[model samples]
Target: MSDEDLRLSADRVLARLVGDPTDSARLREDQWRAIEALVAERRRALVVQRTGWGKSAVYFVATALLRERGSGPTVIVSPLLALMRNQVDAAARAGIRARTINSANTEEWDTIQAEVAAGEVDVLLVSPERLNNPDFRDQVLPQLAAATGLLVVDEAHCISDWGHDFRPDYRRLRTMLADLPQGVPVLATTATANARVTADVAEQLGTGEGTGRALVLRGPLDRESLRLGVLPLPDAAHRLAWLADHLDELPGSGIIYTLTVAAAEEVTAFLRQRGHTVASYTGKTENADRQQAEEDLLANRVKALVATSALGMGFDKPDLGFVVHLGSPSSPIAYYQQVGRAGRGVEHAEVLLLPGREDEAIWRYFASLAFPPEEQVRRTLDVLAASDRPVSLPALEPQVELRRSRLEIMLKVLDVDGAVRRVRGGWTATGQPWAYDAERYAWVARQRETEQQAMREYATTADCRMEFLRRQLDDEKAAPCGRCDNCAGVRFTTEVSAASLDAARGELGRPGVEVEPRRMWPTGLPAVGVDLKGRIPADEQAAPGRALGRLSDIGWGNRLRPLLAPQSPDAPVPDDVAGAVVTVLADWAKGPGGWASGAPDAPDRPVGVVTIASRTRPQLIGSLGERIATVGRLPLLGSVAYHDGEIDTRVPRTNSAQRLRALHGALTVPPPLAAALAEAGGPVLLVDDLADTGWTLAVASRLLRRSGAAGVFPLVLAVQG
Candidate 1:
């Protein structure tokens, strides 16, 4: 086709994409180059551009043109459910049919697949996770690879481990790429890949070694419409106060980004109490609720959605007025990506960061969950290899000490590395020799540390905040963005009122979070030599417990976290902490379903007190027990003892089954305490410093019940999630 003819053809597609007349919509030069590579040249391409830079337009346009030429349906590997929904809608505006097969719509997948087979679908969207499904991989993916006209990897940075949001499921795309028929052009798209991540993703996009000469289209990472600033808050209370005071002043309905689920919920509650209409969006939210929250945000029905990274990547709200971070993300690349969500479809949008003192601690906590050490990896492999049958995750947990989430992550990595295969029943060892990539993993960790430092620099730098973030992404053209606070001076007041501050302080200082009792024991305990399995007998279980605060909460948790952190010297419980515990008890006595609530099912007041002896925090736990017993005048039964004085330190075990083993016979009730339990014949306050895996309380509660207690009421200083 002649160049002018191609330009006119692209213009018509652009018009459809934007719902404008053909002459009013035209592709930029760089966008045209990307189109040429994908359509005319049939070449692989990686387009690294900023948000609102028409990356989607390029793909949708290409899809329309390709479908017109009688190509097979375009397969798009999208990351989030939100992203898939938005893309499907955009494809429709461009007059292209798009169907998605994701976890949210299991019932419609068969119909969607049939439509694709019948050539009724122009584009198909599938999440990275779906690529690993046994049925899809065995039946659908092979046929799709052979017939797919073009493969699009949305948020392709996920393919690189170096990327801030690397997903192992995305790495599974390698097998799909290798299976694609020759000349099936592939396109990788993202707005946040730094140089290392870009190179990594480009390398993976290749169908073969020499043939992988992808057309790389790089664009400047600058948001002309965003005005950036950072305010260093002294504490969480001050930060919450600042948001509560100034949230209504921001432009349009926006988002408040928090670092933890507890923080998200806390912020949402505080804002609502302050009369702001907001909702919480986190990984814990149900799909239906998440959809409603997204819709509310999109329609401006609410002021904002207080969300974690769960609301990120592809939530489409053009003219979103502002984005405020309650705490900064660990990496500048990630921060830049998140803030980019603002100012995309508006003339000007506000981007502010209220970094808290607890931010680094949260960062370190997350870093601790990164890829495990070589020994741990090898131990997992050994467990899988020892068994002849495929082992389900629940069944494998008893044999390995990793938590369910982390263990699942490790298995996915192993699956990608060809060390294991996820079959119909579960996972099986492939018997293929696998070598640990120590150097590579170490490099990724170090890179993370470096990125964390860069974010710190971005927060404190006197230079333009946008320029600092741009430099972190290795955008060589980065320059001073005059719209930021550093370049234009502070545009908003950081000062908050004494009343607001006091209100926030009161809310945060008020402590006590309900900790639901574990009903079912970790699955697969029998395989590891433990007798416990299935639903914990109701008779042997602990009643729902109460903790002063969650270890990740922005409130009292901050005060408790440092004292309980590793290597901290043991000390007596502080006076204020003791008072808070008393307050918690008083509230427990008077709160709903409490002993005073008069509900028939309410648990009876704990008649006697029992303390779980802590190996490291013995002084703290002992003081807590003594003070509570002294104040309430309840008899203090001699404490449960770790047999042989060998304490089962909660730090070493990462998962439930391991903790159960370490605690099984690790605690024995003193004969006097057992006798006291029989005499009291009512619930006892089980005092402990912390509850990590909850196995200690479960086992202890079981023992106390067998000794004749009516119920166990657990009260802990903190709940470590």
Candidate 2:
């Protein structure tokens, strides 16, 4: 029969099977037009679209239409056994005849093959690995070559090296299609692909340029309901603590992603200890265990799940409310896919990235480990090339002396290069040259390097974290999302009180203080104040007038010095100067009742205290002193009042503005240079080198107030106001 006449007869058979003489299934207009053109011209076609864009719907409806026209039986090639089962189940739901062939059906395989050869099976779904069976080619292909109506390749991106999930067996599909009878329509579908992947899909399906055809349906990449955020923390422990605090606030199904199988187990154990029913899935898990874990999550037996990235592909549960990465992935594409798993049904979802300094290092190590040496590549090629047909890894391993771990890594690399195809229990050489050019391997290596660099940059960048990620993905045009850590305006704050400063300065400037090599102390060290001279000596020095002037040249003349001592003068003061120096005063000494006492020697042990100027406002000072006195045995250092004239306010405020003036007063307090300052019972002293209107001091005092601080007192070396 002529090609046209055979095509006409096939159309009649397809119409009868699908029950739709004219397909009216809703599909993107462009895709519909492309399919119609394919059918009209009697040529093969491939369609690629983003995930959730209805690629399956297009092919399924088209299959129905073609079948209604009496087209011969159609065949579908899929990668996963579960996906094949899903397809068969879906067809059954639609009241169409469909069957699947895989390793699970040992006894039924021959019967199914015979049924397909006899045109008794309307649709047959099989894995690419199954097609490598010689019987399929010798028997099924000839029959299908004569009457095959349609061939569909789902998740066609798997055939391309550029795709996230590359499969070796997919490479042989083009050769298999070439062997099929001319004008037997081919339809390929996939959810995600970039330009390179798109080209690869077309080429692998034997639908290139003019001989065959391709149609791409683009969809919006943005997911409005998916809120993205990144959190920077000192360590994983802190991250766990943060998650613990926020877990209750984040209700609904959630997935916490970790980088390693061990981390997944660790985090899951930690969460379980905290009373959360958590399940973990990682590569180390047995298939039965993984399946059970997935089922438990789906059945709501667990509210939270901790897993490695292996849990996501082909597992569809629509209500996932959150996806959090315990560490950053190597590329934005990897992250995008993992996060995309959440909110698949278009519900509001949140994705958080909790990263630390070690995350990048771990990923780089893994990448280096995953990159196989050229020798391993050569061996993989040699073995596959020697095999007349595909050889299973189990059989090939006997010939290669490399460890299985190393061998598998090499196989994955070769699979990505399209040098060999993975068949059921074996590996097949496609007989076609590797799709990648020599430079392509270098490009992939560089791409991996770039991805690692991008991940490191994402973790370390000071800019808006989300903006950095969006830009890395070539989505720079996207606006800054306001929900991330950068947008939320959270920062670390350390408040140094006058008491802590004096204590640190006393220890650092003590005569023969016997400073430890590391300055390590059994108890924590106290905060210390530094003079304008920025030097520390055992003894008091002349007024640092000139040094203070020099400090004023910089805006930091009023800034607090954390851990520096002021320079001493040529002259020395006696060590016996008792009350002149405010030592570490006890918290009780500053409270109401303890205000009656004067500065005493350092307590044998640690005690929280603040020494205020005696000349300062008594009510304010006394109230603080009384609060300090509540520490009982810890003596309250009587409020040492300072001459109002010695104090300066950079920003002046009226007495009626108690809030502002008080805030200003606290910010200008002089600090004893120290890394950290502790507060007494109630009032905390905030010291700055210079002070303006004390807005910063006031704001900080407000923060302390929220922390149950009685009040804030300010001390400054210089005052502009």
Candidate 3:
């Protein structure tokens, strides 16, 4: 087709996409350039444009033109389920038959693949993780790569380690690209990519050695419709109160972003209590609930959805009038991607950031989960190499010190590098020479630190907030956005009503979270030198326990974080913390399923208090146990002693099997405690400062039960999420 004909065809498709069938809608020059590059020249291209800048239109229009020319289906590697759903619906409007095969719709995979093979589907979208699936990678991906006319990589920055949301699975795209039939066009698009990330992605998108460089079309990153601002509050309570007071006054229905899942739920509950319609959306949200919440926000049926980064990409509500962040993201690039969700279709939308003091702590915790050390990586490779058959993740987990999630990630990277291969049962060693890239990992870590420092500057800087973010992305056109808080002299007020403030305080201050007991033992314990397996006998299980609050909770978490820091000196429980602990006990005693409940099934009241001897916080846990026993008028049974203080501090945050192995036989019941339990004649209270893995509580409870206590009730100061 001639250039003019291709442009005309693309313009007609754009009209259909926007519901203007009269051909009044037309593609922008850059959009036409990309479509022409793919169709006319069969060239790979990378388009780095801001959000809502018609990146989707370029691919859909290109798909229409290519299919009309008898090309095979356009295969899109989408990141999120939400994004896939939106693109599928959008494709239908342009008369393109689009189907997705993702985790959400596994039952439809065979049908979708069949349709694509039949050339009945115009576009087929699959997640990045799907490319690494053993069956899909070995069976379906090769055939798809052969027949595919155009491959679209949405959110392409994810392929680069420097990208803020990088995933190891995305690197699998390299193999697919290398195997693609010659002259098959590819397009990679992203809304957030600095210069380094852009260069990295473009280089990777190039189909190996002989395929010349990809055409790069970079554009400005300015969103004219957004008005950015930052409103600093005294604390979490004040921040919540300010949101409760000002949410409704925002232009229209929008999102309230939180840095953590606990914060999302907390904000949602507080907003609902304040008579505002809201829902919580996080990675933990059920798929059906997330779908419903997305629909509700789109239809303006609810005021807002308090969400984490799970709702960041591919949600296309162009008229969303506001974007509010309860806590700042760790990277300015990530903050830009999230806030870009707002003001896409509207001319005026409010973007506010209420920075919290806890953001850096949360950042540090996440940073610790980065790629493991070279020693751990080598150990994992050695284990796989020694195995005769493919090792399932659960079976491999007991041998590797890495957590299951981290282990899976490491395996995916190895698979992409040819060091390992994911097979029918699980993963197998390829005996491929793989060098640990310590220097590269260290460079990425340093880059992350730089991003963190930039985010700090973003929150505290008095300059234009949008401009600061744009510059972080290496945008050359990042002139001062004249409509920001610093530029426009602060469009919002920090004053919150006294009533709202008090209500927020009450909601945050009221504490007492249920600690669900560990039911079944970790699998493959025998492999870890522990003699446990299958269901934990119900008789040996600890009863459901209570904690004053969660370390991730916005309310009590803010207070407990500093008190429990690794550097915190061991001391007696402070007066305020002790008082809160008392309040939790008061509530738990009268609540349902409590021993003091007058119900028929309630257990007998705890007869004594048994504390777990803590190597780090003995003063805190000991004093807490003494105070509880004195308050309840129960005898203080001797503490559960660790034999030779053989505690493995490294096991606290590790996988279940490793933790259980470390704790087996390490804790013992003292003879005095056994005698006291024999005399008490009723249930006893187990006091500990914290319950991170719940392993200690479970082991201690079993010992108490075997030693003659009728029941064990665990009382802890905090629970870690």
- Model 2 over residues 575-606: C-alpha lDDT tens digits? 22111112223323343333334446321222
- Look at candidate 1 and tell me the lDDT of residue 391: 88
Candidate 3: misplaced stretches above 4 Å? none
Residue 82 CA displacement from its true place in model 3, Å: 0.9
Candidate topping lDDT: 3
In candidate 1, list every pair of residues with a backbone clash.
Answer: none
Model 2 misplaced regions, further than 4 Å: 1-48, 81-89, 103-108, 114-123, 131-148, 206-210, 356-358, 369-371, 379-401, 405-438, 457-721
Model 3 Cα lDDT, one tens digit per residue, 1-721: 6778778888999999989957899889999999999998999999999999999999999999999898999999999988998999999999999999899999999999899888899999999989989899989999999999899999999999999999988999999899998889999999999999999999998866556899999999999999999898999999999998999899999999999998999999999999999999999999999999999999999999899999999899999999999998999999999999999999999999999988888888889888899998898889889989999998888777777888898898888889999998999999979999999999999999999999889888989888899999999999998999988888899999999999999999998999889888877778768888888787788899999988878889989989999999999999899888888888888889887778899889999999999878989999999899888888999899889766556664556666667778989998988999999888898999889878889999999999998888899999987
Model 1, 1-721: lDDT tens per residue? 7768877898899998888963589899989999888888889999999988989999888888888888898999998889888888888888899999999999999999999999999999999999998999999999899889889999999999999998999989999988888888899999999999998888888765344577889999999999999888788899999988999899998999999999999999998998899999999999999999999999999999999999879888888999999988999888888888888889999999988778888999899889999898888889889888988988887777788889989899999999998899899999999999999999999998998898888889999999889998999999999999999999889789898899899999998988788888887777777788889899999988899999888999889888888788998899999999999988988888787677888888888889988888889999899899888889887688887767866435588887887787778988889998888889899999888888888989998988888988889989985
lDDT of 1 at 79: 83
Residue 638 in candidate 2 has what lDDT?
Answer: 35
**Residue 148 in model 2: shift from native, Å?**
4.4
The RMSD (Cα, Å) of candidate 1 is 1.2
Count of clashing residue pairs in every prediction: 0, 79, 0
The best-first sequence of candidates by lDDT reads: 3, 1, 2
TM-score between candidate 1 and the true structure = 0.98
lDDT for model 1, on a 0 to 1 scale?
A: 0.89
